[model samples]
Target chain A: MERKVVFAKPEALTDAPTHYCPGCTHGVVHRLIAEVIDKLGIREITIGIAPVGCAVLAYNYFNLDVAEAAHGRAPAMATGLKRVQPDKVVFTYQGDGDLAAIGTAEIVHAASRGENITTIFINNAVYGMTGGQMAPTTLPGQVTTSTPFGRDVKIAGYPLRVAELIATTSGAAYVVRRMVTKPATIASAKKAIKLAFQAQRAELGFSLVEILSSCPTNWGLNPREALEWVEENMAAYYPLGDYKVIDEVKSLK
Target chain B: MAKILMKGNEAIAEAAIRAGCQAYFGYPITPQTELLEYMSRRMVELGRVFLQAESELSAINMVYGAACAGARVMTSTSSPGFSLMQEGISYIVCSEVPAVVINVMRGGPGLGNIQPAQGDYFQMTKGGGHGDYNVIVLAPTTLQEAIDLTILAFDLADKYRSLVTIIADGMIGQIMEPVELPEIEPPQRPEQPWALTGAKGREKNIITSLYLGGLPLEKVNLRLQETLEEIKGNEVRYAEYMLEGAEIVVVAYGTAGRIAQTAIKEAREEGIPAGLFRPITMFPFPYDRLDEVAKGVEHLLVFELNAGQMLEDVHLATRDRLPIHFYGKMGGVVPSPAEVLAEIEKIASPQRGER
Candidate 1:
């Protein structure tokens, strides 16, 4: 008997290297998403939406057909694409600034409507793309370029807990928050992404996987220090947990 | 197809549904609010998506979403709301998403009036949004034409894979007229292999308009320019009345065109050889026919509900061959047929210096 080989390169487009700074977990999350599409054998039919913040250039790295949405409007655009082409896999990669701030209404309505699309929300606790601005997910005491004197709760208010808020909505089928600072966390992040895509494929409604990513350049930390910083400062504020898992809940319902 | 009396707004809404528009997203603005009211009552019974969005911005985005999903989606707004929607409209154009936008224009540079105006002519034709792009604009003169052109707008949108705007005014949206609804057929939608439903077993297709490289972006622009040229060549439409042997021609569109038609009738009855030229496709401007009319006529009168917006195009078409007289009513006022007829008579009278 003769053995035949059937291995090939990932179908994602081979574009320029990502524009994320060193130690930024956006690259890791991107690789993991690419791997999920490859593993699920859906790279050829997957469409990713790029938001206006750090992931704005997501079209460059993701080999699939990528649509760049205006700041904070990715969810709405994804809803359009997914509703029209319900057979193709649709996902949105959005940043904390884009998702929780300017696009708040879109996010809330899309979640409430349970639009059958996947959202990959990267919450770095700071606006990475726009030079260390205070984001909606910024930690309470963390100082950004904007919150120079530490986030004064009296004025700036506390950081928003998006996963928790979105999880309360009936439209959200799966909502999880996972950090990507270590290998174990990375493995769990991959699982979350796979399950989110699975929920989308099942037509179970909207799925969101919030990745707690590191922004070393924005955080004013070295690569290794940034990884440690996310593990130390961000993890406590945005605890890693599955807020809602539809497969388990549906079995009960 | 027997004529039935219908409110202009209700007729448009019914015609849109009958034409197989499965989803509608809109924000309420005065003068055109009845459109949304009609959709709200009808869409639920028809099993279609009808959402009164949080804002005009979100409404257009919802239309964008539904269009991307391969549904025949539409949205309606008045002037201020339409202005708010320009961002998403630009995105739809750049992404080549097929959808319909109905701008029942009221007056404004800012909330000008709730009545009627032809002020948005430049905004509709000259790329109201922020981009180097164009939307297929249809100007309907009657409630019947409103229904017919709206259905045609969807077809043109899909055929060209672009956005189409039915640019009417509050008069058309508010007035009652007899219209015959066309027999609605199930739309024969093209295969959207690029749509993002699920990967299933096919290759993932991404629909994007982001081309960073200069060479690739130029190629996209060239292709778009070519598409516009083809649209202009084939889609220019107009109605010419009494131009074969007339001394004066009046140019107008939408509500103003209907007024011009009446003016032409009155002028002829008054022993003045006056004609009317109504442009259906405002973007293409019907320059060829305008030139033809210009050659036979000694004077041209352009009437509008704005500060002589389309008159500029009429002048460009006639190349100043005939002296063009302008009559307009601004701030949501409609130019009456009597007023337009008076302008026609003024232009039709033999010039003091000429034979």
Candidate 2:
């Protein structure tokens, strides 16, 4: 009897094992992006700009032309690459601290300019690579190393709803928020990722997908509990939805 | 092309375009703003890339990206703006991508004034950005030299796969002079195997400044040092005027160098054996040549638009073999030729006798 293979790693991912801690969802998102690249048959024509976070070594995992950017400058770097090579698909992989805090200017301007690039923002509520610390997206009353007694709203402002902020930009064509806590949401996230890339391929303006991801090590929870926490706490604040879908992007097949 | 009267800033832009600079990203800053304005129109007309970035920080990173894609890229800024770009510049240098940067300097320790000054000497030549790296700095004295050096900047950047900076002041950036612009055909860029032009039919390339391990980072620093050593050996540039029988050598660069020429000529006619040593390359400074000049001359006078910034380099080069005199006007003051001549005369006078 002959058996058909149903599960295998995407070709877009290299054979190297990731350095992410156990239960971290960075691997899941990386695989999803690889799968999308494989489905689109664009691995050869894709360039990835990795941020200065846990995914700083993303170049090692993705089998594509990759460039590592200075902290919070990935969007600007992606714009540079895409402007010169419009035929190639360029994307940036950034974490919450990189996108929402230090790199806020770069991301905001990139969206305003309507630069034709895709961004995959991982909103994990804490700075992962440098150990757990309060990030721009850290929820109110959430405790991290820096916010030892839980974040105080009076001292630390409310968490930034990045997707909503990006949606308000006139130049943004597609902006969405999704979580990978369950298989259904994972599928929706992959769909959103594909649409963002599609928007770029169709010459639409900037597109971004903000993924509400998990950081078990930083959150001090098991991988299973982290998913439940994201489902219960993060999803409430950063509700999953299509925040911005311009007419041009919505019309894309 | 025939000699056309062009502002120094505009000529630098034209020369860069002629040299096949494919992309230009910059922000609006005084003095250097004209360069970005000129590119905004000309680059679009010529079907090249032009982007008015949000800030110098964004502009430098954009140039970094375009450069990583194997495109000839450039950016221009002033002192404070250049200060903001230090991080991106450090990353670009470590990544070893070819890029051109034009710094039309202004008075500054902190937003001092918009007038011309060379206070960035220590920053430009001594690695303004953090890390063990060096950028090739070219100081052009005249508009014609600005044009010529702007073109040379592209070639040198590409040749060394390093950042080449054109350090001018508001004097050179805002002044006007007739220049014969070179007509260069579009460059046929050699294939860069390391460039991140998608990995079509090849293994993917990674351009990064991050080396987590000690040995790997050390290797990167060692390699950068080796490249700098090569640049020092091959790219040191300076010019001498009336040094045939000179006893007193006035060392300057950019506007200071241009002004010193007049003073030297006036001193020459008055029987004072004064000559000018103008450095074209600020980095890989003419240390050896200055030492050679020291061997022939009795006194060395360093003049600049800043408070003796280059005097430190002059001191290092001469190694205290002879007395080094410094005359500088800080906070955007451009001393007249007569003022410099007076300084030269004071040094030349038998009464002020050999300090």
Candidate 3:
């Protein structure tokens, strides 16, 4: 029999211990991004701007040029990095709280300005780092530390369809939403990240892929239940699909 | 170089471009709005990076990103806008990224008037953001000094790996003065190995402030302290006028300092023997010089556009050995030269200048 290695970690991902909770799917999404960067042969040129949330230590895990950004300001940060160093592939890895809350203005403006960059948005309904506070994307009737009884649309407001919102921006080159809970979805999520990076490689305008992620610790469920919750609940509200592409953008290729 | 008549705000902007700042991220706010507008036009003409951010919060972070990527970047704001940037400022200092910030201070505690006020003296010198850190603050009074300091700000910031503040007031910002711009080619910054350009053919570079363990944080803080001590030793700057045989010295900076000079002259003609001691650098302030001056004066009168903020530094330098009196005008009301003169005259009077 010939010796062969069938599977291995992506070169972009460092051999570092992850700090994610047992059932959380952030590690899966991280791997998907790493694999995408590796396959594109862009690991050396990629500069990742990590947000101020659970993946704040993304710089440590990703074996590439990385910069830590203040909460919700990664998109704006990416814009600066990309604009100054157009040769460098700049991207921002932001969570729901970082993208939809305080950073909403940054993303909207970056997209509006048509910055040449990529954004990986992790849509976990709760604030994972602060111990499960209700996030802007928290589903209606979802319970978290901030919404003890359950989130009522009347009191807590409805969840923002971030993918759809970003899709509406004329400067957005590509906008997508994908799930990473299941193995099949993980492959698709990786594809989405690749397309987003590809758009940037072509000097396209802002590209974003919102990944529906699982925060089992914050959701008060096992990792298995979190995946099930995404299949049954999250996927329905934030239907996974390509919302926008370069064809619709006038300035981008 | 031919002297050009320019507003303080526009002069600072032109000086920054001449000083080799490649990128500028700013939001429009009064008093300093011209700074952003000038950069907007000049950057486009020069093919440099310029962006009018949606807000001050985004602007500072943009500077943060550009600076980490090995570009000299800057931003400008007023009081409320500067307050919004506290978090980013804290991060910048902690991450040790070199950036230049120009605060054309307006009256503040909140949404205060756009008129000039030196209310931000304490905010600028004593570290507005959270942490045990200090930024090298250069308080420029004259438009010429504003131009000179703005140019020096970029160099000193990069040289020390720290943020440098150009604290100007609306009085200086809106006024026109003749300034001889320095004629020097903007030197291209050599590659900084520490900056995160890319990981190609080299180890990855990370621009981060997170020190998880206390031991690591302690080490980082100690290193920062060491840098600060070096700055304190060599970077102190100030200017004194007519300090010889003075009974009272008016300690002021920026616009207030400019006004104090007029007051001191009138007081001198009145035979009051008053002089002006102005701090050129707010942080790493000319404390030793002020102490030297404090020993000769009977009273150190601190005048400001705020309710006695820089009085704290004057007190620290004098250390109660000398009596310090604070005279301030707040809420966008800048005292006239006569008002300051009266304060000096009152301090010299036997019946009025009592302890």
Q: Write the per-residue lDDT of candidate 3 for residues A142-226, one digit (tens) a residue.
A: 9999999899999999999999998999889999999987778988888888888888888778999999989888898888998
Q: Candidate 1, TM-score vs. the true structure?
A: 0.89
Tens digit of per-residue lDDT, candidate 3, span B40-128: 99998999999999999999999999989879899999998999899899999999889999999998878889899988887888999
Query: Residue-wise lDDT of candidate 1 within A1-253, one digit each (tens)?
Result: 9987686445664556777777888988998898888888787668788998878888778777777788888887777666556678888899999999999888888888988889899998888876899998888878999999989889999899889999999999999999888889999999899888888877888889998888888888898998888888888888889999876434532
- Candidate 1 interface RMSD value: 3.1
TM-score of chain B of each: 0.96, 0.98, 0.97
Note the DockQ of each predicted structure. 0.44, 0.91, 0.86
Better of 1 and 2 by lDDT: 2
Superposed by TM-score, candidate 3 places the C-alpha of residue A123 at a distance from the truth, in angstroms, of 1.1
lDDT tens readout by residue for model 2, A164-187:
999999999999999999899999
Candidate number that wins on TM-score, 1 or 3:
3
Q: How well is each residue in B1-355 modelled by candidate 1, as lDDT tens digits?
A: 6889999888999989988988888888988899999999899897777877778888888787777666899999999998888999888887777899999999887968898998998888989988688888999989999999999998988888889999999999999988899897698877777554544565545556677789987887788788899999999999888776788888889998898998899888988888888899998778888898789878888889999899889988988987888899999877678878777766666462133
Rank candidates by TM-score, best first: 2, 3, 1
> How good is the docking of model 1, by CAPRI class?
acceptable
Q: Could you tell me how far off, in angstroms, the CA of residue A28 lies in candidate 3 after the best superposition?
A: 1.3
Clashes of 1: 22
**Which residue pairs clash within candidate 3?**
none
Q: How high is the lDDT of residue B183 in model 3?
A: 78
